[model samples]
Target: MATSRTGLDEEFIGRLETSLDIYGIRQDPSLPPLQQTYMTVRAGQDGSAGSARLALPAFKGDKGDPGDGFLWQGDRTSAELAALREALGTDQRNWAYRNSDNNDLWVWIGSRFVISPDAFGAEGPEGPAPILVGGTVTVNGEALDQPLGTRVVGSDGVYSLGVDLPELPKGEPGDQGEPGSIFSSPDITGGPTDGQILVFDNESGKMVWRDGYLGPKVYNVPASAFGDWSSGLTGTRHIITAITIPAQPYRYRLDFDGSVEVSSILGQTVDVQVRADDPDTGAMVGVAYGNMEATGWVNQRFHAYSPDPFTPDTTGIRVGVVEPGVEQTLHVVAVKSAGLAAAWRVAGNGRSSLRVKLERMP
Candidate 1:
C-alpha cells in the first residue's frame, strides 16, 4: 500500500491543545471557485478543498498601561468642566457646603453645594450600602460612593456630585382658575364674586378676578365686558381710573338738557382748590391743588384750566364718551385775594374757564 500521509506536531497547532475547545472544517467548495490551497497536517486535509472554523471559550485579558490625560490649555480639572458638586459632612451654612445627611454627613466634593437624602441601610456590618452619586464606589464595589472630589478617574471623563435636589418655590398667589373655585356670573349686578367671573359690559377690556371678596381683583367695566373703545359713541364713559385705593373710578354721563341762563354767582370766577373726590364718600380727596406760591417744585400743581371737565389716570384719561342727559360738568377757577366787601377782588368775577367734566351715574 502506498502511503499518502501528513505529519502533525505542536508547531502545527496553537490553542487547540485545550480539550475544552471544539472546532470543525467545511468544504473549500464553500469558498469562491478558483483559488490556491495549502496542506494542513493537523486536520490532515488538502487545503485546496475546504474552510477551517475556529472557536473558543471566554476569558479575561492581560492588563496594559493606560496613557496620559486631556488638556484644556491650562485649566484645572474642575475649571475645565465649569463646575462640580461638593457635599459637606456637616451643615455649616457655607456657600460650598451641601448637607449630605441629617447627621451633618457631608463631603466637599469639588465646587458647588449639594444635599443628599436619608441614606441609611444595613448592607454592611454597621454602615449602609454606598449610593452612587458619582465620583465614588462602594467598599465592596457593591455601589457607588458619595462623590466628593476626585471619586472618579479616567480619560477625559466628567465628574458628578450626585446629591438629591429639592423642589422649586411656588408662584405668585393669583387666580388659579380651579374647578369649583372658578365661576362666571353674568347674573352679577356688581363685580364677580368668589368662584364667579363677571366680564362686565359697557367696557372694552377684560378684568380677571378670582374668588375672594378680598382683592386685588379689578374690573374694567368700561372696556371689555361693557363699552366699546374704538367707536367714539359706546354710550358709556370710559371710566379712566383704576378701581384702586385712590380715586377708584366710576364713570357717568349726565345731561342737564335745555339751556338755562348761567347763574351769575356760578359764572363768576372763584379761587379753585382741586381734589380727587373719593367715590366711597363724595368728599374732596386732594390729588393736586394749584399752589399759587411755592418753589423748588417736586410735584406739579394744576396750572392750566381744562375747557372741559376731566378725570385723571392713564392712557384714555380726559378722553371718553359723555352721555346726554346723563353727564354734567365741573368747573375750576383761580383768582387773587381782596377784602370782605370787595370779595370779588379776592375771588373776583374773573373766571379763567369752566371745566365741564361729565359725571355719569344714571
Candidate 2:
C-alpha cells in the first residue's frame, strides 16, 4: 500500500465510522451498513413546476358531490306517497289496533308509536307501553263494572253490562207426607192369666200372652230303706226288695247295697242282679248283673239303669242274689229309685225297702 501525506483517506474513514454508529450497524453483526440514495431540490417547491406547494390542498370543492344515499331514499311521487299512506292505514287498523271510534289504543309490536292516553295533551309519539286513564272498557262486548286502578275480571259464563251484579235469593221449603196404616185391636177371648206376659207369635202373625216353664226339672231321691241278712242262699237270685214306677216317658236308675258271707277254706262265687218288670203283666223289662269273690264278708254296691228314654213296662225293680255254695247269704241292704218328679215306697220288709223319685227329664 502507498502512503498519502494529504489526510483525505483519514477523513473518508472517519466519515464511514460515523455513519455506521448512527445506523446501529455493529450490533447487527450479520449485515453491513445499508445502501441509500439522495435527491437535490430547491426548498419551498414540491417538485411541481407550477405555483403549488407541498402543503395538503385546501379541502376544495363542496365535498366533491356527496355520494349516493340509502335504500328507501329518492324523490317522492304520488304512487310512493299513496303506498306510504296505505302502510300507515294498515298499521293503525291492524298493528296499533283501535276500535272504529279510536277510544282505545293497542301496541301490536311492529307498529309505529302513539301517544299514551294520559300524557301532556297525551301528545308525542308515545312509545310501546300504554298508560290507562279513567275510561269505559269492554272485552268481547261485555262492559267491565270496575273503576280505574281496579283489577278487571272477565265474565265467568254469565254476560252482563257495566252495572254491578247482585246475588240471587233462596227458595222456601216443601210440605210433609201422610200417616201410615194401623189395625184394630181384636177381642180378648181367653185373655192372658196372672203371671203371663205378651209375646208376638210369628207363626200365627198375632200378639198373644202365656205362662211358660223353660227347662227340664231335676229330682234327687235318697235312701229310705236299708237291711242286712246272714242266711246262706246259693246258686239262685233271692228276691230282697222291689221298687215300682208308672208307665210313661221316664229315665229310671236304682242304687243299692248287697253282700255275701264266705268260708275261709273254699273259694265262693256270689252273684247279684236287678230285675225290672211290668207290675201289671209280670213280664220282665230288663236285667243287670254283678258279682263278688272273697274269703270273708265281701261287701259291694250295685247301681242299675234302664236304657235312656225307657218306658219300662210300668217299671219296677227287684234286687236279688246267687250264693255259689259257699255257705253264705247275699244280702240286699239299701235301695232307691231316681226318676221323673215323684217319690214313694213300692215293696219290701222293714229291714229292706225302696224310695222313688221322678224327674221331668224331657
Candidate 3:
C-alpha cells in the first residue's frame, strides 16, 4: 500500500467524483463533491467494464408537470366567488367561468395545457376537475320552481314528500268563493194589494218565482226564453202594472261583498233584467225583464227562497196584504226585480240602496 502525497487537491477530486460509476455516488459522501448524477461503482474483474459507473441523473423534479393539462376532481375546493384566473395561452377569452364549487383554474402542463379544476378544489394533489358551469336539473322536464330543500317525495305517480325544509312554505287552498247570497223582500205601499213580490240570489244571480204559495225545490226548472210579462197574471189580486228603468246605462253584472264575476248578463236564454241607468246622460235604457217572482201567502209566513227554479221561492218571506175584516188577509203587491246595475236608486256615481226586505212575520 504505497501512498503518494497528492495534497487533497479539490480540483482533481471534483472531476473524479463527476465521472460516472464511482463508489462515492450512492453513499453520497464528500469524496470529490461535484454532484450532478447518482452513481454506483461496480467492482468485479470478470465483468466487461471492470469498474462500471452507473450514472443516474438527479435534479429537483419541477413542482410536478403543471398537471396533465386536463384535470378531474370531485366537489370544488373553495367558494366559487373566489376562484383564481387561468392564463391559457391566446384563448384567454374563453377562460371566462365563475368558480363552480371553488378552486377552478388552468394548470400549465408541458408544451400544452388543459382546462381543469383548481388544485385546492377536490383531491388537490390529483390535478384538475370538471368545472360545472350551469346544468339542467329538472324532474321530467318540469322546471324546479320550488325553493331549495322542498320536501318533494314522489315515486313515478305516488307523491309523498312532506315538506321539511326551513324555507319552503306549506301549500294552502284558494280563498272561499263569495258567500251564497241571502235576500228578502221589500215593503211597498202601492200596486196589487195581494201579490207577493220576492227577491233573492241562488248562489249566482238568477231570481225567479211562481204565482201561488210553494215549498222548497230540489231540482232546477226548465223554462222558455220568451221575454213576455205575465200580463194580468193575478196574484191574490195584484196585476196590471208597468216596469221601466229611470235611465239608460251600460250597467254590468251584480257585485256582492268584494267579489266580481265575468259572466255576461246575457245568457243562452232570455236575458231578463231590470232598468239600468245610462252612465253618460243619466237617462233610462231599454227594459230588461226581472228574473224573480213571489206568489203564495196563506199567512205572513217567513221562507228562504234560495233563488230556485220555482217552489219555495222566498226565504222567511210571503206575499200577503192586511184586510180589515178578512182577518187581516192580503193581496199580491206590484214590485219589479231590482238590479244592481247603474240604477238601483237615483243616486249617481255612488253606493245606492237595493231592495232587500227584512219583514217581521206575524
Candidate 4:
C-alpha cells in the first residue's frame, strides 16, 4: 500500500457518504428484470475482476393507484390522517381531500349541511352549491342568528327563520265566539221536583237534574184548643189537633212537640202522643208518644218514622194527649211534625198547638 487513495476506494467511500433517495426498486433480483435495475462498475485486476456489491435498501415497489377522485398526497401525520379517515367514515356526505404534501387536510361538506344562505337558496343540484364561510344571514331586513339550510318553499315566498322566533304579542281574543246555544227551563221534561235545580250536560246536550232539596220539610201547626182537662172529661184521650195525609204511600219522618201546664197535680203521670189514624175507620196509622210527671208545666218532644214506604191513613193523622185522672188543669201547649201536614186545635181556654211535616222517601 503506497498510501495512495485509489479511485475505486474514493468513489466507493464517497458514494457511501452521499444520501440517495431511490424508489421503485425490484424486490427479487433472482427473477427476470423488472422495470427497475441496479448499476455497478468493475473494481479488481490481475485478470480476476472483482466486484463490490452495492448494499441495497429494502425494496419498495411502485405505489398502486390512488383510485377515483383521490390522489396520493405523500405521507401524512397520524392526527391528520386520523381526522381524514374519521371524516370519511362519519358521513358519506362529507367530502374530504388534501394537497400534494398531505398537510392541511381540508374537509368539504355538501350544501345541505349547516345553516347557509347558498344552501337555503339552492334550487337545483346541477351546479356546485355555495360554500359556508364566516358570515350570518338576514331575511326580510332582519339579521338571522343563522341562515336556514332548509329549502325555501311556498308560493308567497315566506322563508323559515330556522330558529326560535321571539314570541309574538297575543292578539285580542275574537269577541266571545257567539254564545253557546241557550237552554231554557221548558226544554227539560218530567217537571223538576220542588227545589230541584236544572243543569246543562255538554256531553249529552240536554238538561238534567242535580237533585231536589234534601233538607227536612217543616210544617207549622197552630194551637186551636188549649185548656186544662177537667176530671169529668168524657174520655182519657183528648184530640189536640189533626193533619190530613194524602193517601199516597210515602215514607215519613214525624217530629212533634207539646207543652202542657198542670197545677197542683204533682207526682201525677200524664201522657202525650202524636197519632196518625184513618179518619174513616178510626184506626191508628203511626204514633209517637211521651209521658211526664205532672208539675207546674210538662214539656214533651217525640219523633217517629212510619214503616218503610209507610202509607199514611187515608183520612188524616191525629195528635192527642192521654190525661191523668185527677183534679188537674192540663193546658196543652204545642205539637209539631217534621214530615206531615199542619194540624192543631185552637182551644180558647188552653194553649194547644201541633206542627207536622211530610217527606216522601220514594
Best by TM-score: 4
The order of the candidates by lDDT, greatest first, is: 4, 2, 1, 3
Model 1 collision count:
47
Q: Give candidate 2 regions above 4 Å deviation.
A: 1-226, 231-235, 246-267, 278-291, 306-359
User: lDDT (CA) for every model shown?
Assistant: 0.29, 0.34, 0.28, 0.40
Which of 1 and 4 is the better model by lDDT?
4
Candidate 3 per-residue lDDT over residues 64-85, each given as its tens digit? 4542233333333333323432
lDDT of 4 at 234: 22
Q: What's the TM-score of every candidate structure? A: 0.15, 0.22, 0.16, 0.31
- lDDT score at residue 284, model 4, on the 0-100 scale: 34
Taking every candidate in turn, the Cα RMSD to the unseen true structure, in Å, is 29.9, 29.1, 25.9, 20.4
User: What lDDT is reached at residue 331 by model 1?
Assistant: 22
Comparing 1 with 4 on TM-score, the higher-scoring candidate is 4
Candidate 2: tens digits of C-alpha lDDT, residues 250-319: 3323333332222221233333334445222332322222222233433333443444453523334322
Better of 2 and 3 by lDDT: 2
TM-score ranking from best candidate downward: 4, 2, 3, 1
- Model 4 misplaced regions, further than 4 Å: 1-170, 174-210, 227-234, 245-252, 258-270, 277-297, 305-351, 359-362
Judged by TM-score relative to the true structure, which candidate is superior, 2 or 3? Answer: 2
Model 3 whole-model lDDT (C-alpha atoms) = 0.28
lDDT of 4: 0.40
Assess the local accuracy of residue 187 in candidate 1 as a C-alpha lDDT between 0 and 100: 38
Better by TM-score, candidate 2 or 1: 2
